[model samples]
Target: MGQLSKIEWTEATWNPAVGCTKMSPACQNCYAEAMSHRLKAMGVNGYADGFKLTLLPERLADPMQRKRSTIYFVNPMNDLFHERIPASHIRQVFDVMKKAPQHAFQVLTKRADKGEGFVASYDASHHPYLAL
Candidate 1:
């Protein structure tokens, strides 16, 4: 099942991977930082390392498994393009998104350069489901 989200702009949350690092002055009050720590303290499955950058390959299929259409805020607990997250893993997440066309993915990231670079190199044109 997809995780229902409280975030106003999106219908559900999908953290195929999670965790992020402080990148700038804008990160001074990141809600993810506090949430990760709190989730870790509560023994949340994917937050064993707390706010430290980590990957959860198992969650990659969350969206595909859900039959209903949804708007997914990808990696809401952290930036999807964090320096520590491998590009290959990001691709895996994208591959999942490409397969699940019923959903719209909102992939917001503080690391826009990396995000743009990934977009440039990723071969999405051939995929009928991927919009861009």
Candidate 2:
């Protein structure tokens, strides 16, 4: 767990999900894809599926555990909004983030086109902790 992240924008990083498909030329040298294979070789518990779309529900609460307010780069290793992932699972992730208001979550996705509607439709009132 990096309380201090090497990523320029965020203070910490989190990956509740991992693995992605090569969608464009930008994905040719994906660091996450390479790292996922290495992590799998190292026998990391969450990487058993190795570059396949795997959800690590156990890691969802990582940000909440940190008492200090911080910024988390959510799913830096994968696109959390991938179309292959269930909408319900994405909601589960949002639910976890909703409970941890002390931290800010940064989720970037190339597959936003597929999930943006769902995000727009989510009831923000019911989840005050989440920004959207």
Model 1, residue 59: distance off in Å is: 0.1
Instruction: For candidate 2, write residues 102-132 as lDDT tens digits.
Output: 7778888777676577778776665654443
Q: Which stretches of candidate 2 lie over 4 Å from their true place?
A: 1-4, 126-132
Range of the 10 consecutive residues with the lowest summed lDDT in candidate 2 = 123-132
TM-scores for the candidates: 0.93, 0.86
The model with the greatest TM-score is 1
RMSD of 1: 1.8
Models, CA RMSD each = 1.8, 2.4
Per-residue lDDT tens digits for candidate 1, residues 47-125, read 9999888888889999999989899989999898898889899899888888888888888888999988998899887
